[model samples]
Target: MSTATLNVRTGPGLSYPVLTQVHRNQTFSIVESKKDWYRISTDKGEGWVADWLVTRESTGSLNETGQQGTVSTNGLRLRKGPGTSEPVVTILNKGDIVSISETSGSWLSVQSGNAGGWVHKDYIDLGAHSSASASPSKNKEAKQGVITAGTLNVRKSPSLNSPVAGAVHRGNPVSITGSVTGWYEIQFGKSKAWISDNYVELSSTPVEVPATSSEFTGKITVNSLNVRSEPSLNGNIAGKVSKGEKYPILSERNNWFEIKLKSGKSGWIAGWFVQKTVAGEQKKSTSSTQPAGEKVTILHNGTNIRSSADVQSNVVKRADSGETFSVTGKQGNWYEIKLKDGSTAYVAGWIVSIRTGSGSESSPSRNTSGGIRNKVITIDPGHGGRDSGTIGTRGTLEKLLTMKTAQLLADKLKSAGAEVIITRKNDEYVSLPSRVSLSHYYDSDAFISIHFDSIYDSSVAGHTTYYYRNYQKDLAYDVHESLADRLPSRDRGVRTGDYHVIRENKQAAILLELGFLSNPAEEANVTSHHYQDLAATAIYHGLNDYFSN
Candidate 1:
């Protein structure tokens, strides 16, 4: 599971384009690992994310720790805390030896020569030391299994980095003797075989019960899902449930859940598609209720609908591509939809397109409930960590000022009922394309990038709002007008910008240049807490107007 709003890139490095952005608590299975990155396999496809940004869920029963590293850079400071502002305990020069004890994001707790503190992990070169060095314990209970994987690699040790001992194909028989951290210790030809638990299915696979009582429930996060007869993908589909449907989880088997269906029969669902919830706890699910006068359009062809109260029928609805029919009534999972011929037929509600009848081209309807309430917005504080951005004449950092302003705005936005996703939560350099990818990943209603401008010419000074597309012009105008009315700086006016954050964005994205950091006087004014509050408040007011009006 990711601990922050992290980018899953095409490759392990920042140079690669971002494939998608995964937020906090979203888990994906790791297929491979290289250096400080993990190759994650999702239903969408495979991508890579920095290991520091995520916490791995070990389905296995053991955890291995302790790695060795050497300092890669000279004058790397060992700080009292994980941040740059923390006091320096001691500075270590090039080739300094250290032990990595803990990790907090990009920072690693290092100990060198009787002195221990936190240092950035980028400066430490970790060696190829194997994890779980000790051999896994032998399985006392003899077991048999069939290799589910097409070609499963038998490793010399439990670690993925271990040398390949042999290979086993599908339909091959295996004798299991022991296990460790999700790896099976099997008996191989004259040697012990260590295989990943994910590849093989034992006759009596070890069942790990996640919960026993009805205290744990699950909420369907996907638009539609199939409830099955058993806990595996091969199980027959017993029923279908739309997003936000809740069910009491009866038990767990191999990560799948046995849920008590509404009809009282227990059915299995994929655990990954459902968000676990406490039974008595209330969660504010995403908007699913239909707005008045809005009709429903079929999302897929040959979708099922109820022909009678007891039976379902597959019927085709005739309409133009993007056309919607009036919804006369809702019956269970079916909607009574009026056809092009003026005759009404019941259509499956889960397979219908969700679009507003107003047919908006200027902006996406985040929620008809109004304002910024429940709207997902992305707020990006530009240039951080290694990217210090522009430096003011008096030593003021543009990154620091932008972070301050963004945080204030984030606090206000959260208070006003907005679900905000911060591109960089701290002093971390986020790639420009990844920031844009985050907006699209979350389906953001609006994306705002906060920045401070600078140049060789200190005389130039002002605040400006920039939009890349015609659809973003309205948002730009609203925010710029508000900032101009409130700040002492000159109004640079809203204009079309060619910046990466907005130019590559598909959502309503805008960049705000709060003030010219190169101008000593302007920098002094904008960096003040009072000025930041005013700027943040103005932007908040502008967003409110844009959403409510």
Candidate 2:
């Protein structure tokens, strides 16, 4: 479709109610069209926007206008213009939602759902139109079968020792037919397979235990850690839970434990570094009862295998074998697997596959959630403690200032029910690596570094959002525009920076200099409580703009 710019209109050269403003590089959806006007629906709501004001940079939403309601995810954009040459946007949050209208080559007509604006898809998911559905729903039919015992091989192929495919959880099911030595033949529906007889517990009738609740399954950080009761260090140890272990989460009480393991084993696991996995995430295979020998191939590169999924401190290796590994456990594709060396590894979802497996591992790529999409954001407060970033004229330490701003942003995000992470809570020097590490470590949706601007040239004034990556440009633009509109400072405009913090960072990364500290007037205004809150509000809205679109 041909791209257009949307102007929220009141009269010629005038606009009111504003409903919401779509800034440069933000995206939106075109629900309908009329002469010189486009009826647009954003994360905000549906409204009539001027076609002149709407630019090709504006993106549409996931809900396509066509029937069958094909969802479009590739609409998020980081843009210079509606054109590809525009310096790419960067630092896109993981779950930033966009409204896609049409596309050409690499350019996508888009807008942020929350903060309305036009942006290009240079650095975002440029969803291509498809006539077919993405995939069938996983819950359509829950197949029932018997469990085959032993070290069941869920191979990509129906073979044995075929690179030792994944194992079946202790009580899952399978359709047993015959046996080959210690291995038993099973029917995995369209395919038949063999699995070891050591690990499974077989039952004919489908035992109707209370269906697994859609509950949080908290994590265990250590490669092999034990679950225990009571908060005290000397509490009673319940059982050992492995890394990436999804312990059925009970409720949390202070620093203590509360969990439910397999087979109704309920107790507490320590609350440090362990977080419950979100529900609907622990989706069991259709053949949960069948220990089929299914296999998977590495779909992306740099898939990390760890001693455990707990900490990155123990990375075993970057994967090889484009190896067909079995899926022992899957919680959002951060699968738990027994490595070729009998170790464990955490493979990101995008890097591997269970069917038609053929792909390379070790390449840098990002994974998007299949459904129930939510935004993932990482907020970094620049400098802290002794490393008081740039000092302001009024003696306000940049670190202190940004920390307060960061806190405001964090609170706003949390209140909105979004997962928010602040790099530092106290005064302490945080290495740049650590900052980037935190974002990459979590496979964050987006990485935003908060800071105030300073320069030897005191005349360099106003606020500017710096982005090194193309995908982050719209984010910078939306945020910077929000700040300019909310605060009294002149818009320094979003610009490109080669700052190490933005450059080296892998995820969508942006650095904001919230007005120049060297300018007494701007500095004075920024230091005010109102301005601080204003900045926070702007950032929040900018984020909303990016994700809501």
Candidate 3:
């Protein structure tokens, strides 16, 4: 079932031609699958569909498919979905023959006699046969490319070494999926071939606007927000604005807001610091967009409103002694404030006297400051919806913890002027491939996957950062150092691992194992609010250093 209106392509990857269109709630039986796409028996006939747009369910045991596999493990359980947490539909024994349908990371959708579900690919032996299925729907936006070569061979896959099935001449038109680096899809039957676009003329021309999108109006949440020329941190600074200012959201790409600037220009702002007001409900909304909580009092006239939780951050404006501002959020020893012009700035916690709604006054001691500005960062909160992730000794759920961490990290990053994109905003299962695809689509400056680790041994506890490619090791080391410093757990250091999210990602990616949920004492400490804030602050500083260096 498609969760939203979806596109059915001729082959697995985005480079393929669109066969037809399907709307939400439209059901299609699985004919076969390759990679992250499924060959579904739709009403229009069998076409490839990206698995991310549809929800999977066990529809009884399926028949044989193109690719076949043998169960390697004895008594391997077949769950309804890819993850281990998904309910088991049935079980299989060693050497049991199963038809491989689709794949989601390390898991494969398979079928056998009276049994249909997902099993770990590690427990399945799929021979040397190359499954002719490949999916590319994660990059659903429209694109077109013109062939440059007078004669070019279209290979069966993205690789140049793959066998050529056909050819296309100059002046032939092709749909660009941007799924592969050098290849443009001009798909054929079972042997879907791709053409090289090394010198081809390409343009990003969107064919359709997703039906699920709605009108949005955004109110500035930060003190002074940086508007970028493009929907990324790398985009040149086009303009600036202050808090409380409202603008019609011209467009939204990923989590960046494209708004009409005051100078009769258009620019994109990080959506993290913008209060979204959907069309219609704008009038009944509250005036405050910041999370209303503690209020701070200025002791001396000419006090400064620094841009971030740092003393060195440029003074945006001056404040008179005894002036008060709501403490929207706290970062170590800094109090985040929204100025009259709607500029967000940080006042040192040690200097300002804090007053909460309950009338209690206090001063903070801890001071923290490193912030990375003008960078596009993607935060992936691992596991969601049906995937609960690792369950800790104290019943600490890794999914919820990662979400909390990602939120705090995003807030701090936004305050520091970086555009932040989150893979999962709520409790929803996002496939591993989709997460990496988003990073690629956004051309993110950095990608961080947040997760809490676990093991059978309850006594071991620590925070470890994992990287795949050598290019990402520096990021892992930088982030892990800060996490190990701020977190109240052991320092496991940085190491290379084969995690799918980081391994498959083309961008600078790293995965953080913030702490061990298997350890009882560590779980209690890691679940605390203070620890999470410190962790976020530390990571923020780490990125600051990484980008600066």
Quickly count the clashes in candidate 1: 4
How do the residues 152-226 of candidate 2 rate in per-residue lDDT, one tens digit apiece? 345422223122222343334555655432245554323444454333333435532223564345656567666
What TM-score does each of the candidates earn? 0.34, 0.33, 0.38
lDDT of 1 by residue, 1-549 (tens): 424577889998756899888888887877766755899986558999977567766544222246656778876777877899986655576665565656767888765643567899789877542232323233464776655555676766665555455466543456787775447887654458677765554544332112235756677878888988987767899998889888887887765789998788999987766665435323211122234566765433334444431122434443333456776544332356666667667653323555455753212222211377677889999899999998987789888888989988886566445789999989999999899999999999999999999877665678999999998998899888878866656898998999999999999889999988876556766887657866886787678667776
Q: What value of lDDT does candidate 2 attain over all alpha carbons?
A: 0.56
Please list the residue runs of candidate 2 whose C-alpha ends up more than 4 Å from where it truly belongs after superposition: 1-374
lDDT of each: 0.69, 0.56, 0.69
Against the true structure, candidate 2 reaches a TM-score of 0.33
Error of 2 at 406 (Å): 0.4
Worst 10 residues of 3 by lDDT: 205-214
Count of residue pairs whose backbone atoms collide, per candidate: 4, 97, 10
Residue 390 of model 3 has an lDDT of 99
